[model samples]
Target: MKLVAGNMLWTNINKIPNQYNYLNESITCDVLVIGGGISGAIAAYYLTKSGVNTVLVDKNIIGYGSTSGSTSILQYEIDTDLHGLISMIGEKKGVKSFELCKEAVYDIEKIINDLEDDCDFSLTECFYYATKASMVSSLKKEFDARKKHGFHVEFLDKKDAQKRFSFPVEGGIYSKFGAAQIDPYRFTHALIAKAVKNKLKVYENTEITNIYPKEEHVLLETKNHFNIQAKKVIIATGYEGRKYIKEKIVHLLRTFTLVTKPVKNFNGWFHQCIIRDNNDPYTYLRITGDKRIIIGGEDEKVGGINSKMSNLSNDDLVSNKKYELLLNRLKSYFPEIKDIAPEYQFSGLFGVTKDGLPYIGEYKDFPNCYFSLGYGANGILYSILGGQLLRDSILGKDRPELELFRFNR
Candidate 1:
């Protein structure tokens, strides 16, 4: 699949800051991570740091896949609301999932600090507001649920929200902790660089076409006919990893994003906090370190498992109309930021599970293999959490929390 193809904001700014040689001959390792995006990079970081001989390969340039098109808004909040998740999986496990995500944000912070390159990572508050009055009550319930679980959150009314945002908010939940932003393209490269220094082998332009799982080990074949033997494998291919699983567990949703030119002043964007609404097919807004405005939303479902998704939409008319709608939404939100327009707009495919958590453990049939599919809006955060679990699992230690995100769950 053509994972991404567009004038991506992050990749465009970085200009392919890093590169690695592709696989040419057969190799062997303790672990093989397929996909060189943020998830693969994170998993490689953990394994290499722990002294595991690991190899990572990607079909395209590292981080140029969906990671380049990522909005990179890290939040403890899942795409599913706490109340809804509780109904789906019960309170204890549901709350645990949210808490894991919360800790993942700090874990990511620590990783960046250790690397000495934060990748434009910043801790910020997240404002999940309701656009219409009908959403206010559910918003309140969400606030109460979060507060009851000891999260740092505040209930905001219309008047209170209006005070912080340029446009009026019906009501919302203000998350005071565990939300952040980062440049994913740079972050992915940073992790791979650090991992290479720690002795991880990486290859690009290498596509794995076949998997042969044996009783003792697994053999993988690249498109070039090279063979790789490993004790274990990590399928961190993001949305594209769906091809490996037989059962349907996720829906592929296409999302659009628009990034505007730097504005003179942020005007009413309150501390440059992340802004997301409670509407169906919700929209999110964040400001980059360079002060460019990013507004992402407008989700649509793929027609089938084989449906093609490119970073640039094939239909110019549809893509233009979508981009126009996103720009107009931003203008409406902050009319004070005059003469602002998006210089970058792109589309990418991401997966969403029913319970709003990522798949992060061994699948039933994929013996000697684990998947780190960090789908949904919390992709980066989930990747951080998944990486740690994968490392532990590979090291012969199992985490009970992993059951919460089991493929059959």
Candidate 2:
């Protein structure tokens, strides 16, 4: 299924062409990871570092999937509010999820520093601004809940928020920590390079058609009729794995993004902060190092396993409409933008679970098969944490966060 049609951030940075064809014969590995996005790459990296025989495969190049479409805003705040999260899962579990997200942010920072990647990694202050008075109280409640959970957050009134941020806003909550931004494509490519250097085998342009569980190994069938045998398998194919795990709670939502030409004197409104609002189908904005504005939003549920559709395509008009709407919103909010028309426009799909919590851990009844999905726009941070969690699980290490995001309860 094609969620995004045109070239995106991932495609723009993927200049080096490398393709791994389908497996021609049976192959074995200690651990096999499916999908070559940030999650799979990081998972392979960690596993290989632990001396595990790991193999990573993807139908296309690394970052060719949803990773290319990501806006790359790394923030601890989730799309769902803290209070809402508490309502979905118990307060204790909700708080645990919140802490896991915060840790994920730190994990990314440490990874970038260790890898010495030149990706545009920057520490950003994230804000959830209130557009209407009704949302003001809700935002305040979230602020209080977050603080109660030991997070560093401050409530900013309208005047204070306006003074701090260049953008026109009424009030908001500011978190000085657990927020960051990066060029996801570059980060993913760098991680793949590191993984390769660590002796992790990766296969691109090869799609896995079926997976069968055997006595002591799992058999993976590629579209080219090649077979792979591995002791364990990881399904990190994003929304593509909804078919294998029949959970209706997860919804595949389509979102569009556009990057405009760098605005002169656009010293950036939030400085390092990834800006967003507290609104349904929320909108997020951030300025790149080159001074171009990157805006993303307009989420609509298209199709997944529950839908009647058999195949998905990116050539839909709905995606184009959403792209235009996003551009118009950007122009309206920031009139200083020279040209509202974006230099590039693209759409990508993300899976959102009903509880707004990612599902990570072993699949039910599949002893050696694991799955991580429904991370939404927070895939980068979660991918980092998920990789470590998967690695620890394989190494028989204790990871407390696993209880909060395990699949099938």
Candidate 3:
């Protein structure tokens, strides 16, 4: 799949600063991770830390795939709201899901600290607001549900919201202490660099064309006619790994984003909190470390329902139009920020599961292999949780909580 297209801002701001060679010959390892993006890097880091011999391979340069295009908003909220999730899968499981995601945010922070690398990580609050007056009651219900569950949150009415921000919202949930932002491209490189220092072999520009699983081990054949043999394999290839699953669980959706020129004043914006709306195709706003505003959303089925959107030809023109719409939305929300024009813009595919939970465990058909598919807005956080869960599973200490993300579920 063409995971992303057009100009990507993250890659423009950071360089790998280190490089690894492509796979040229056959090799063996305890674990072979396919796809050296954020998910693969996290898996490799944890696997190697547990004294397991691990190797990671990528079709393109490390972190240049969907990870480069990721907005990297680490929020506990999923594409499905809390109330909606409860309606789908009982209250106990729904609450557990949110709690796990909330835990993953801090776990990621700890991983960054353990690596001792600078990845532009920061903790921030979020404002999930209603876009229209009609949506106000639903927003209040969501706020009440969360607060009743003892989560850190506050409900803001239109008057309070307008007094604190440049824009006016009918109502919203002000979540405290459970969201974050990071430079995903930089974090991927930093983790891989640290993993390399600890004997994690990384190969770039190496594509796995075929996988043959044996009774004991799996054999992976590369595009260059080389082979990789491992006791177990991890498919961290994001949406591209959907081919391995017979069950149609995730729907691929293309989302667009634009980054504006740096702004000197954020006077009306409250604490520069991350902002999103209650629309079906909600727009999300965040501030970059360099003070640029990133506005993303306006999602349509990749190809408008049936066709392959990735195969479309006029991607550049479509990206421009999406950027224009995103800018208009941003201005409508915060008209006080003037002279802002997008310096970079891009679109990429993200998988949305029916329950908004990622698939993290092994599948029956694919023996001796684990699938770490982080499919939602909180993909980064899910990857962190998947990495730890899979590490434990491989070590013969599988936790029962992993059942929440089992494939058959």
* Highest lDDT against the true fold, candidate: 1
lDDT of 2 by residue, 1-409 (tens): 5656565755774475445555566688989999888778788878887889999999987787777888888888877888898988889988877788888887777778767476788877888898887789888899999989899998999888766665667678888888888887778778878777788888888889889977688988998888889998988888777778756647776677888876775432555477899887889998787767899888766664454222334445665677778888877776654655577777777777767777788877676888866476677777877788888988888588888777765
**Can you tell me which runs of candidate 3 are displaced by over 4 Å?**
303-308, 312-315
Residue range with the least summed lDDT across 10 consecutive positions in model 3: 305-314
Top candidate by TM-score: 1
Instruction: Say which prediction, candidate 2 or candidate 3, comes out ahead on TM-score.
Output: 3
lDDT order of candidates, best first? 1, 3, 2
lDDT of 3 by residue, 164-267 (tens): 88877888999887899999998998898888878999999999999998889999999999989999999999988888999997888789889998988787
Best first by TM-score, ranked: 1, 3, 2
Cα lDDT listed for each candidate: 0.89, 0.78, 0.88
How close is every model to the real structure, measured as TM-score? Answer: 0.97, 0.92, 0.97
* lDDT of model number 2: 0.78
